[model samples]
Target chain A: MDVFAFFNLNELAFGLSKLPMFPYFDMAHYIISVMSLREQPGALCVSQRSPLACWFSSMLYCFGGAVLSALMLADAPVAPLSNTTNLLLATLMWYLVFYCPLDVVYSLASLLPLRLVLTAMKEVTRTWKVLSGVSQAGSKYSDALFVMVAVGWAKGAGGGLISNFEQLVRGVWKPETNELLKMSYPTKVTLLGAVVFSLQQCRYLPIQTHHLTFIYTLFTVTNKTRMMLLGSSSHPLSSLESFLYK
Target chain B: MDVFAFFNLNELAFGLSKLPMFPYFDMAHYIISVMSLREQPGALCVSQRSPLACWFSSMLYCFGGAVLSALMLADAPVAPLSNTTNLLLATLMWYLVFYCPLDVVYSLASLLPLRLVLTAMKEVTRTWKVLSGVSQAGSKYSDALFVMVAVGWAKGAGGGLISNFEQLVRGVWKPETNELLKMSYPTKVTLLGAVVFSLQQCRYLPIQTHHLTFIYTLFTVTNKTRMMLLGSSSHPLSSLESFLYK
Candidate 1:
């Protein structure tokens, strides 16, 4: 038996592809939404906030990406909100994370082990969304690399891109906090992944989706693990970024 | 559609039961093992430790439950270590969590979102193991409720029970820090859960596995959430304990 075969990236990617991903994605997204909402300077404290306001803001943040993608591709803003079960689950998760007594859900969700898994799952979903967006746009434009990359980027980081809009919906205005000014690692990676995926779709690159998935997974996992371990103050990829830009 | 049916516990349990469990259990258990090992007063700092000693102690802590359970039931100490894949994965996780440069894995694993999910998975696995132990003992002993509960307790909390032995293996003997003197929430809950499961197995309680799973999950999720939110200093169930005892 070949020892190297046991660590095959293709095989690993195949196994990962088989796992049910949506639940992990939804949970991770909701957690991120709650965290982001809490970070908003204009947001009211949980104790002082109205339940309706909380639900509205959280739902907006949680479904921002899907809504944005739908609008970009289908010209329909309400497409993502049509699913009743998805809406209910999102609201339930948001409520639990933000309004649950003693803030138990938020506290537990913030723990390292759970956070690491959620972050990994979220990245996996981002990869999937980016590819899906590229394919969707390719079907329409069929050779417009720029459009495909733009759509893919939107699908992957639409939520972050729309943070200012989301905050506006919550009656807060912070134009300076727009994602473009302070691009997150996820947003940056998504843009880069979008470009590569777009190139592949246009026959400029010859990589398989699973191969890309494997590479993206490896990259995100290493970076996320480092970020979690080193504390948020220490940039996990700063050294790599410096070397690349230098 | 009846809105109440949407929140059915049985349906929820069935859904949860269908999800892949072992991966979550294994990951959660490894995180817990890494944490407990780090807490040991006799253990050397990661930077000061030999790789071999670290591997030995971590593997021992990680597999202590299975090894102890095998001794109690199958009378074979090495039965659990027979699988090379399980051993390799365990060692890999142990190495990453404990010995990874910059403590990245440990930091990532400690994050709340990931920790919450892992802890929930751990409790779910605990409930399963407790029931399994009760059923296994009942099949052999036929009418020994005490024996069933004892085996169940051992199965659920065996890792903690053998911590002193694990420490001794690491060249650190601290009889005072035994699990009996400092019973953690999981250990206490496991014992209680074991007794209840034993009763159910003996036909004394008119409940099913899924029902117990639902209840156990609810209980632990609530308690764990509270514990996480209130910080470790706040005893989540202390108020309830006082009320019940009084």
Candidate 2:
């Protein structure tokens, strides 16, 4: 019974609307972003800062905050919510949940180890790029790799909805189902993002890339199948992959 | 008339399947990935390559390939032509179009400089990370920024499909519409992915971060709203936003 409850997205998502202290959460995030800290450079380490880096870094924080703020407001009182608000909120959530995690854990305080949110939050922090500049190709390639996974997941999710819009419509119409759909899809995206990054990171482990690819393809197959066969299938890839597997 | 055709997803996506030769393309990408280029690693240039870095590098190629393969197989000999395949293909398409461009252009050479695809692919290449060693915290923080944009995009697309399932279902049932859906969603995802990246990259431009955030949140509101109002919203945020916008 306990285990079963954990698997239920609906039950799990029900409490999300009542998330506590979002202002605090956002505030903590803001303070962390505004203050810039530099580590002592080693003899081996070089210090190169882009003049325009400030603009890039600042807006990221603001936009990210905007997104988290939107999510926090999800349970708040945005009177006369517009279709536009919902879309922006959704877009922001997708972006934040998937990529924000790469930097989240570093900023989160130890005192507020909230378990309820940890499932989603841990992912935000779990991936930390061990910083060592290999080359421009290396850095750009890393960015490219991240883009691939995020895009791959997007592709899967988008297609799933297109083919099965009826189920989505039904879920959206139902309160708990709708909320679960909203929360779960991002969770799935976050998970997929992490998975892709990790798989890429695994290459650092010495396994041949093609071998890893085979395993990844299999994992992609299995993981996707599981999403379709088991859960409500928030994403297109999961549902579709599972559908194909069957 | 030609201009209008150029804008058409169907017209553009038509030749994607018969790509002259994938092996050569992959070979070109491998060379590019291996060759390290420099932009301007002035302030701090750091080079740290974990032995494991290679593993991470190789798998991305495979995963990206896997996704493309799965998408390519959508219309192939996967018997029964089930719903799951359709869903997976759609999701993959969404993910691919949005994010695949970054890697696509470098590998795609002169033959298929297809105008529309180039617009998106060029953005992918334009936003390269000028890599040098930053301190661990610095690199990690930068990683964090990247995470935010990626996750936001994922959330937008996932939610888009879920809310607009009916249109999706109808699209899936029809070949032209389905093809357009498959092609267009990825294009949207790529465009969004690139946009998020460019905004993040603006940090390199030497502007004050706060001014950037103020401008950013406003831009976020407008850009998201614009996305919602125009086009066949492939992203949840767009459709939902448009729904509320209307």
RMSD values for the candidates in order, in angstroms, are 27.1, 24.9
Q: Give the TM-score of candidate 2.
A: 0.22
**A145 in model 2: Cα distance from truth in Å?**
10
lDDT (CA) for every model shown? Answer: 0.71, 0.31
Q: Which digits, one per residue and each the tens of the lDDT, describe model 1 over residues B134-209?
A: 7777776675676577678877787787776666666765543445544577777887888888888888988776
Which digits, one per residue and each the tens of the lDDT, describe model 2 over residues B39-148? Answer: 11210111122111222222222222222222222211111112233324333432332235564632443223332233332222211211111111133345554443
Q: Cα deviation in Å at residue B158, candidate 1?
A: 62
The TM-score obtained for chain B by all candidates, in the order given, is 0.86, 0.22
iRMS values for every prediction: 26.8, 19.6
Give the per-residue lDDT digits (tens) of candidate 2, residues A5-96: 46663343334323342334333333333222111122011112332233223323323322222222221223213436433443343333
